[model samples]
Target: MAFVPEEDTHRSSNSTYRAVGRADQEPLLGKQLTRLPPSLQRPEDRCHATYAIFFSLGIGGLLPWNFFVTAKEYWAFKLRNCSGPASRGYPEDSDILNYFESYLAIASTAPSVLCLVANFLLVNRVPVRVRVLASLIVTLSIFVVMSVLVKVDTSSWTRGFFTVTIICMAIVSGSATIFNSSIFGLTGSFPMRNAQALISGGAMGGTVSAVASLVDLAASSDVRDSALAFFLTAVVFLGLCMGLYLLLPRLEYARFYMRPVGPVRVFSGEEELPQDSPHSPLVASRPLGSHTPPLRPILKKTAGLGFCIAYLFFITALIFPAISTNIESLHKDSGSPWTTKFFVPLTTFLLFNFADLCGRQVTAWIQVPGPNSKVLPGLSLLRTGLVPLFILCNYQPRVHLTTVVFRSDVYPVLFTCLLGLSNGYLSTLALIYGPKIVPRELAEATGVVMSFYIYIGLMLGSACSALLEHLI
Candidate 1:
């Protein structure tokens, strides 16, 4: 048995950590704390290794998608004049080039909901190791394939290339969804900080990719080289994630929390496990075989927080990258690099990602409005106003909506930052609050369920983005 500090034992009562015995089993609060070998005692995080690893895994979860989307120059070059004869530059008239972001958004998000459902079903049936590692391997393999295609000229087979690229995006999205959900599910067994670390890491992943896009845009002349560099960086990062995941089990802190707790009654805060109780320090663990908890109770418990997460991401997806990327600078006629090439990436991708990172990181220090507060849902609803605000931006080539209400470049910049900051903070609060609201045994499943909410929102939002694009 692992030894938990006295303070930690007290904290366990309010958290999911408790005995994992059969529900019919009586409380063993009076049991004596069995002394364990020094080796088996709970260990420190040792310079926050466990936290760092979870954070890296978070980054790995979203890095591939970010890299894929942020390489706008590469995508434009490949899809340019694809249907017609080989051309030096992308023509403005090309349908694929004009709407590639929308197409890519649809392709990436369409399969995520299904994949998340599949992952939820497999939560009990499959080991976290197998689900996470296999998904990473699949995603890494896809990026490798994409890297190889970077140097290959597809002008003669442009449509085919587009088809293949979309297929690859769909496949990668599915794999990433599984990987992300599984890792997040695993974090349910750890402390709240670990979960926050994972969520913040995801924002960090976006920031890294955004910065990489800017770097490649400035440093590389050829679009192929820029894209190749992007995919290769993802490949290296995925490999590092694989190595870090393998290292996770070796840490004593992780091992202690991840240990299987048998069937125990749910912790309701009214009954405090005795401080000396042997099982009081154990965190929630995923039970094997047919012992998985029913999904209904878990859903019922987390319904509000789940909605907050889903709706938050839904609004985020509705405008970001799809509509946000299309909003051009007001100074496009200036012919300056800042107005021409860097405006969209800087204002949309880089700034948004950085602000998002800041938002998630703030959760590490402060979490307000609590999980059950109605204020959360109110915040989510307030974000809907941003949709129209974005739609009224300087979106070029507008047919149906001719007015640009926020004419200054500062409007998009300010709007994008606000969009990202709100998304990161609100979503992280909801995600971290989810498993805590459920029974100890149901924490992991609840985590997966919460993830389903997010992806389903993303899928619905992605579909709506396309419609909204047409409307604009």
Candidate 2:
């Protein structure tokens, strides 16, 4: 070989090593946004399409439940004679309607509680696609069955079968808990808006159901026709939810979440590993090449946030469907066969639903301060007082306040709106805030835990609403 200085040889070797390093880093550079601190990431990094998907998924999950609950007038009317002869119209069978309402309330929440509890075992352990696809299939199947049952002659299905239908519907609600957690967890890698979309979708579900109920009530001559309309609506929306979820994983943005392990960074189309919090799950010290962390540690970190999340839902469950249905109208004289203005499921319920949607959407503009903000938690606890306030709106013995305080139709509607606004705003904040306070890598697990807490609250609240039957 030609003579060459050792210095030159060493320089050449250094250049070769540098080239090798760059070549090796090329792939990881594209994959490395997780390494960057969140503040440094581009503001426009999030995929806006996911917001719509999350919202649709939310509506899909809750619409079926909302359909049954919102169409309370139709069911109460058709099934009034189940135990005996037809009990007349309007407020004639109020007692029986109240009893059935409580039963359905319990049935609605029981399965959600079960599913949320089981999520610890199912959420992280199951593959994302499997969990999502299975939940959608099961939910869609339930809607199909509901449509078929309602389409058949109401006489063929006895009260016992109606109970069975409630049980089946409850199971679908439970499946929704899983579906929600999965969707919420996936969005942890994106903007908080995506998570809020899921919640807002729930509000939208109620709104849509409310609107449909109004239409059915206006157009249908018979209660059976109303049932058919509601069930048909459910099937169509649920099918759409399924289709949207199937497309979720295929999105380039979703690739961040489809990883075998938790994502190290938020998705961004940039090169080089971004710097993140040193204590972040992505940057935290780990043994060897392991990216998966123990669930226990993640759970421990999120336990407090989970409790707050649970408490918020618990408050909502206690007041909503169960108590909201029991509030007495000031004047039962709308003359419409469907309902009075003050009726629990009428304008009052729809007001709450619409106001709730507005409250959740408000988060897109104004986020609750943070996990440490007492405002959200305080609002949740304050809702407990609404239970008694709403009870007072109805004609009840022992409480003279019932006649004095919420006597006007406007009072209950305003309170219901407030109740809904708080519910939507607080719960949405809890869900959105819970994962953020923890490591990004453990966000998926935190989401499951948060959901578990929410269902716990719902179950307890529904159960507690039963006491109101005795109290009022």
Candidate 3:
């Protein structure tokens, strides 16, 4: 007999019933399980490896999106002014900058909306690996193309070329949704911490990108070089991510996750397994279980979780890059001209990215331990009020009815930290709680739906950004 561990034997002996799973899975489960590869055979090593995969996926998925967002000051300013130092002097054309800002939000919004459609239509039909690989290829190609375009003619770029560039970025950004949604579904078979780890990795990607921008911008007097450094770094990261993903299926983690059936639930002959597991009322313990419930009930169970996820991103996209960038510089008297130049673009961006990363990590410490929390959904709703607060930070002279709170710049920075923390912690909590509350069978579907909702929020926020720009 193959050696089952003592804990496995104990659990099997005490178990009430064998996990009731799909009829097709019986033959596969009955066969002796294959031993894990030497690379990830140990439990601790497997766990570490899994965490790395989740984290890498998060970083890889979000890196391209952040590449444009973190570099907003450079591109938007250049697109409008046609050629100039991005570091100092007020934009000669504020209207053009504002127009690009609204358009930028639209670029982000449109792709996410398209992805929402793709999620329902193509996500399931397409193979997971195929979808991920295709998206990565598109993303890498976009980065390389954008880098070359900027390198060749950023100084003499016309409005027509800039519009084309935005469209290209939108295509790449929208594809991230498909990649991330697929990844979320893959993680459904794992523990909640893996989900949190994935999101934290995304925050990490944004933070690192923002830091790189600051460093690159500081190194070169010319803005074009900074822009080149930014895109080249992204290309390198994407290449590494592609390599990691290619190796994913070979890992023991992917082998385990890709199976049609999930972990075995050994039971003693005497004990009767309930038709439905208490852990997941909608279905049995394993994902491909016989006791999978109807879609309606599964949707109902996960509805709040989905709403929280959607609402969190909605608030985020609404004011973030579009409105946040418009905040006037506060420290004109700080002595250094560079401080005024980089305050909002570099300093504020870093604060939010770093704080957001910390917020996501905090969940690992203060986790509710499990998915059972009534307070979680309500928390998502309360975050909506923060939108107005962020808008209030815009401090322009003679702007009618705009509330300028603490014109000293410190106020927005603090609010930004709070915003980033709440964004990271709340969204991570919502995503983690989502799959846990449902049966294994429905967990992946639920995750896909939540991913859909996230982009929907982004879409709505993008629309709202256009409206908010008018108000400002």
Ten-residue stretch with the least lDDT total in model 3: 10-19
Instruction: List model 3 lDDT by residue over 1-472, tens digit each.
Output: 1222223321110011122244432210121112233564323325477678779889988888887877865676576545455423445345556556667667866787678566645544677788888888888888888888776654444555667777887888777877888788767656555777788999999888888887877777777778888888888988888787777777765565555644323222243324233322223343333332244554665677777777888888876877776676665667665546677755467888888899888876555322334566777778888777776764453256556766666767777887888888888867766655444544566677777778878878888887777766
RMSD of 3: 8.5
Q: What are the per-residue Cα lDDT tens digits for candidate 1 across 411-450?
A: 9999998999999999998898887655455667778898
Clashing residue pairs found in predicted model 2: 34-265, 35-274, 35-275, 36-274, 36-275, 36-276, 37-275, 37-276
Worst 10 residues of 2 by lDDT: 11-20
Q: Candidate 2 on 1-472: residue-level lDDT in tens?
A: 1122222221110010001133322210111213333443232224567668888988887787788787776676556654344344424354545566666778877887677656656554676667877887887788678777665555434455566667776777777777887777766655455677888998999998888877777777777778777888887887888789888777665554444544333222232233332222333333322333356555655565667777877777777777667665545666655446325556556788899999888876555444555555666667778766777666433343434465576777777888888878777867776665444565676677777777788778878877766565
Best by the TM-score measure: 1
- Of candidates 2 and 1, the better by TM-score: 1
Q: By lDDT, rank the candidates, best first.
A: 1, 3, 2
**How far is 221's C-alpha from truth in model 1 (Å)?**
0.9
lDDT of each: 0.81, 0.65, 0.66
What TM-scores do the predictions have? 0.87, 0.80, 0.80
Off by over 4 Å in 3: 1-44, 84-94, 154-157, 262-298, 333-338, 369-372
RMSD of each: 6.8, 12.0, 8.5
Q: For each predicted model, how many residue pairs clash, with residues at least 3 apart or on different chains?
A: 7, 8, 2
Which ranking of candidates, highest TM-score first? 1, 3, 2
